[model samples]
Target: MRSLPVYVASVEAEGDRDETLRELVTTDDPDLAEKPIVENFTTEALGTGLRSLRYTQTEEDRTIVAGVRYAWRSQEAGCDVVVIAAAPDPRRILGAMDDIDAFVEQITLTVSSG
Candidate 1:
């Protein structure tokens, strides 16, 4: 059996929207193997966003953890939505990218106007 770890969250946006999106796609963690690979992404529900690939090496076990992060700023909701998919094996994460992307595409955000 195989498992993929995923996290999804939404937070209030602060400062500039573009800056917030940029920050979400960028990481400066020391455990990272190298600079993350980031790309522009557009989702059906969230609109334009960013995606990043990161590999972090664990110090205790010396294992590489592969992660993919997707971030989008919801103008209607005035918040940022982030989805992260991670796996111990890099190949697992890579192989599941398509499914993960599809899942992201299905996300929907709604805001009511007064």
Candidate 2:
């Protein structure tokens, strides 16, 4: 399968990852699914070595469905992560709101010829 083309922006964040994440989670939408926030934060793993946070957020939710992932790619680690939220899908045109949702999704797949 072919990979989807994603639009990404550079993010360089300074501060505590857990604290920033919590603030982002709350500031962005305090009512978002707790599972995404409470259950999925790997702060311990993301701590210590993290001097500065660098990642990209999804920027496309204009035409696609909701509850879809807005993502960020850890440039140093080569890991792509999603911010658990969906931007409004009313306009197909990209905007600041769209930029808030960085575009990138990573998946594993195997190929076989039959």
Candidate 3:
């Protein structure tokens, strides 16, 4: 049995990055809409033309989750890459942020330019 919400991180290829991001940020769940977003930011980094965003949102049950998403265009890879991390609890997420950031920094992508 899982007490905490199951938040999964994933990366995939997609056509519309902004549209996908908007879908993620906009809360359709009535439970989550009451409070809305707490804070959010976006930037490009990683030296591979990577774009990323981190946002925290208030859940319907009054709990909160922080999420990070990264996207980049890759020709040889056949599509753009999108990476996501969904954290259900701020305290626990914050405590692990340092380790998380370090781990993310190690991710390397080789996109071939044809």
Candidate 4:
């Protein structure tokens, strides 16, 4: 859940998905550490809280498909979903959203003091 927000922010800031991915590779988070470096993904969720993933990276069979799936799911909780695979750089990840722009802008909307 936390990783979803972090992933989006990191990719948006770095502008190079590959580099950001490299950053993810070096992260301390257990989940990010286990993500598979594969080109494809498969996801399965059981009983709402159990999500399992299996994908093939060139080196290891274990992968981070779970986090990716979670991130996609997070958007539905209150956001628009955007999925990107094989982003060599963050900038390569086009179509990034304002992420509930209306919600954000509403914060600035003022009311009469009367």
Candidate 5:
């Protein structure tokens, strides 16, 4: 776990969740533009009030790995929560690319309305 070289964090923001997620997925920044996209998806059925997206990329040298996950807390307030992570080559967390869904399902979120 500690040796995986992975990073993870969460952010809460107010906006059109879907639109924000689209922007992140379609970023035009030159540096990121060159990184290959490994996966992208959205869903409302995974967990309670969760509308989410997952994106992953690997550097050409294969020395770096990065991923982003976006989840909308609900359809009621346009609230959005995003989780992001990065690490050195070939994620060792789940061992295989096919295990991503299982890895994602392990993520838990708590949303509080103010």
Candidate 6:
């Protein structure tokens, strides 16, 4: 069996939540194969969010990479949290969707009372 690379990253940003989420999925790179598949979703920890799946061709080797990004805004915290999962093979990304969903679902943000 062949092994593929998988990547997961998360970031928290303080700014316009909607705009932050939009920026997370937007790319001006010309290497993209086509427009990404974007959709809106609601999560238990976060109220409303966006999920985007995009494919891009590497400039060096021209290999295709599939990246899935999930962005959620914390109204109480006044910030947005974005999570990204990517793999060299699109099938690998698809296979990890469920695990990614569960990981995102378990995220809980805490705000200080001060």
Among the numbered candidates, top lDDT falls to 1
Could you estimate the TM-score for every candidate? 0.90, 0.28, 0.45, 0.19, 0.47, 0.81
Can you write out model 2's per-residue Cα lDDT over 1-114, one digit (the tens) per residue?
A: 222233433345546555554444343443342233232322222322111112223446323322323333343554443344333342322333243332222222123345
Off by over 4 Å in 6: 1-16, 27-29
Worst-scoring 10-residue span by lDDT in model 1: 22-31
Better of 1 and 2 by TM-score: 1
The runs of at least 3 residues in candidate 2 whose Cα sits more than 4 Å from the true structure, single-residue gaps closed, are 1-9, 27-37, 41-84, 87-114
Worst 10 residues of 3 by lDDT: 1-10
Q: Write the per-residue lDDT of candidate 6 for residues 67-108, one digit (tens) a residue.
A: 888888777776677777777788988787787777777877
Model 1 per-residue lDDT at 90 = 93
Clashing pairs in 5: none
Clash-forming residue pairs, model 2:
57-101, 57-102, 58-101, 58-102, 58-103, 59-101, 59-102, 59-103
Better of 2 and 4 by TM-score: 2
The alpha-carbon lDDT assigned to residue 99 of candidate 6 equals: 72
lDDT of each: 0.87, 0.33, 0.46, 0.27, 0.43, 0.75
RMSD of 1: 1.6
Between candidates 3 and 5, the lDDT winner:
3
Per-residue lDDT tens digits of candidate 3, residues 8-110? 2434646575565444544333444243342333223333433233444565565566554444444445454445555665565556555545555565556
13 Cα displacement, candidate 1 (Å): 0.9
| Model 3 superposed RMSD (Cα) | 6.2
Estimate the Cα RMSD of every predicted model relative to the unseen true structure.
1.6, 12.6, 6.2, 15.4, 5.5, 2.8
- Over the stretch 34-101, how does candidate 5's per-residue lDDT look in tens digits? 54343444443434322222234445653434444334344443344444444444455335333444
Residue 112 CA displacement from its true place in model 4, Å = 32
List model 1 lDDT by residue over 1-114, tens digit each: 487867889999888877787677666657789899888889878998999999998889989989999999987798999999888899999999998999899899878787
- Once fitted onto the true fold, the runs of candidate 1 whose alpha carbons sit more than 4 angstroms away are none
